[model samples]
Target: MPFLQDPPRLTNAYLADPLLRELVARALPGALGEVEPELEHLGELAAGRLFAQQAVERLLEPRIEHWDAWGRRVDHIELTPLWREAATLAARHGLVATAYERRHGPASRVHQLALVHVLEPSLDVYACPLAMTDGAARALLDAGNAALVERALPRLTSREPARMWTSGQWMTERIGGSDVSLTETVARRDGDDWRLFGTKWFSSATTAEMALALARPEGAPAGSRGLALFYLETRNEDGTTNGVLVNRLKDKLGTRKLPTAELTLDGARAVPVAGLSGGVRAIAPMLTVTRTWNAVAAVAGMQRALALARDYARRRAAFGAPLAEKPLHADTLAGLEAEREGAFLLAFRAAALLGASEAGVASDAEQLALRAVTPLAKLTTGKQAVAIASEALECFGGAGYVEDTGLPRLLRDAQVLPIWEGTTNVLALDVLRALAGEGVGEALAAEVNAHLAAARDPALRPAIEAARAALARAEAWLAAAAGPAREAGARRLALTLGRTLELALLAAHAQWCLDHGRGPRALAAARRLARHGIDLVAEEPGAEELELLTGPSADGGAR
Candidate 1:
């Protein structure tokens, strides 16, 4: 019997995937000529050294120490070598600093996010803290908190590991899940400083140096309007906890390497980043920044899973032929590729907009489109990651189910995509809200139509028509649906919008390939995605049917 050999290792992500290179070239052709070398280096590191480290450094979870041998209430968290490596790489490469520096103007965001796409999957969940840190920086800048901006921005964006700092987002609490209106955290002023007192549930990246939290002032009105964004450092200069008690680390299903914890504030001192009123509005910039990170991370995970699966297919054999040589296996891989390309197009488009918006170069239409697509991309790509990762795992057969192969971890880690930043349903509601704002839907339709118009390939025609049809249906649904019925079908509508956008982008990429005399990969991806059919035209139910869904069950139980 022939001894089954392991799959060929992917040493360099950029060199391995011509598709990623092509996409970056198409996205920023002029800039790509300059940034290509850096991207290539980053890609090599990701696919080679980082990939090897992840395999060898298995089961590296962060542990929290709440008490010392001497009974000192010292809160210490120990990180694995993988996380340490990720942190060092993040600082050395100016991953966070690049975006803030705006060296490439509007193209800076594109460059930064591209690097993130290559860096994140192998970062051992370092992206979580980095996302929050980026969000915090943008929030501080938008809030125009001069003191906090000067002090925090440097640390947040520093390229030196000793000077760099990660940030935690302490928005979620015991009372509030996604609904910030239910926030019970209280903030009372003591002289010039604000003292926050409450328990924060689900504190991801608990090892960060500081955090951005939402707290309601004592006399402020109720609901989300009363809440204010507060900034707090995790420690004092004396190396003591700043009235912050680390309860315990969460035993999560995935992202176990990440230090997620429950924290209680015994009058933790804080500074207000924005006005006491309209805290949600003040956080708009932060949301824009972080959602883009989530979308990029989702697509990155999908890419990594696909890469591993494709590598495995070449080595594994059945029925006297290699899996890669099997027509059915090829078809499955191509299907996954189509999904990945669609997600990539949608996500990069969002990242580009964010870069433009940050650079103050986005047009009015582009601004509206950015708002609409941020949530759409986040929600869509998040689900796609989990689905694609699961499929990729199956590509390995029995080996994929084995933990030692590092295949199951891809699926486990992908599970966090949908749950992080916001769930699919919550993001759907955000999309609806964006649509409610003037010009968002129109801008989205315009962008999609322009892309569809540019795509001249025969294979893109179906996707073009479907995208147009989906856009029409979305507008109609937005106009007709109201009250609870509108709320009930928000997810369906948001997904339809997201999927249509993806098809439009895929078609556009295919067109780019045609113009550049490239191969059939983009066209193939476009055709497959189009054939999948855009899920845009769900039949709206009548009042009774709507009630059946939203109302109580036969036993009078709530959903």
Candidate 2:
């Protein structure tokens, strides 16, 4: 045989993913036995067929058909076979349905998210629409909207392909992305029905059957408070456009398989899901749900990239031996592994909290911790995924740069994780807000301490102490910094908190592995992660440096 360029064969995702299995076993021990068979099946489908299709079927992309053959305005987006197949597989496997059904109580979310993690990388970005759908369901359920819930919930969680429906979350506009305070969309009363008139600049799931949007009614108060959550079906019963017009689809660097469109809602009929006042507060449930999805997808992408790189390392020899045998390459892979372990712990912790809270089973302290960790996990894991994906790409050297190799797509897709749900800065501020609530910071610290205490390893003591000291410094910074100063350092504080929590969680998992005879792999991961150091927060910049960083100088660039 010549040089033998073959890589390892892809195995079932769930079976191959020992880390996810361990996390699942730790988080939802009882439910794991029930969810295991389904996950194994989903894993097989994902790793074998879905992975192969995504690699060879490079031309798969969503195309928008804005007009019919007769030149009539008929906006329809065509999905590729892979997208359709993946969507069906997702439904059949109970990805969204499991969460809605809550078959396993709070543990159902862990199971559902784990399934999503397995299927995410090969889902052709179908997770985008599913996220919106899940959020919409949660919002409707929380709002006590019996009518809308009755109509949408069943289909949203439907197992049948013909019956299942995805939802679009049309929040972004020409005004801005995260700042809905600048929303120009207006809602009007017409007899018993409400009409929505607005332009949604960025609506993923253009082909969705319904959408949840924010619009202000006439004479409503200004800012986000005036905005109302509106639920509208995008099409009539006859399958005609229900006053929602798809303007155009986005052509982008990544997630091309997702039909993201600019939409116009002209007199679209809608019903208010929550109170007309404080609509921003009303949308919290949806945001929480979507943010969790965003974090899960982020971690899933990281796992996929690492899986490919690790496999390639064993087969792709460098000078004298396989890349896996090289000390430097081994170190790089281990570093990626450590980052991924922390990310996995953080993301799953958020999911577990979401499940507990949604089930109304969370304690007072747990609820506060949930509030802080949700944003922390979303922002931190998203950034981690992008960095890990970049490193994983480099593991393949030149082949990673080649588009046809299916390696570039990993980086392309990873780029969107941090930007979606919320950007880093936006989420950092959200962390600050969550911490501002009574008992949130203390609850978070308590949770971290509890996890840290689980690891009795003397070597882990230093890392544990460093994490506590970082927490103390964060609390001090938050206590001292005020107004603009606090805002300036929010990202640093949030990162420190997020990283500390992750390290604590990893330590706890390492202890669990040690006690359960699962060996020292997890302990090693925790140790490597700790080596990254916990000194994340820094003193505020000097006035001169702050001014230069914040805006143009007072001297108008003359000095």
Q: Write down the lDDT of every candidate, Cα atoms only.
A: 0.87, 0.87
Clash pairs, candidate 2, are none
Tens digits of lDDT, candidate 1, 1-559: 9757686467577777766787778666777767888888998888878888988888777887888999988899999899988888898887889899887888787778888889898887788899888998999998898999999999999999989999988888888888989989899999988999999999997889999888999999999999998889989999889988999999888888888999998899999887777777777788788888998899889888888888878877789988999999999999989989999989889988898888898999999999899999999999899999999988988878888888888889889989888899999999999989999889988988988988997767777887888888888888989898898789889888888999899888888887888877888898898777777546766789766776667445736
CA-only RMSD, every prediction: 2.2, 2.1
- The weakest ten consecutive residues by lDDT in model 2 span 1-10
lDDT of 2: 0.87
Please give each candidate's TM-score.
0.96, 0.96
Candidate 1 accuracy as TM-score: 0.96
**Alpha carbon lDDT at 48, candidate 1:** 79
lDDT, residue 374, candidate 2? 92
Q: Candidate 2 on 155-237: residue-level lDDT in tens?
A: 99998888898998888999878999988889999998899998999998888888889999988988888899989999888
Identify the leading candidate in terms of TM-score: 2
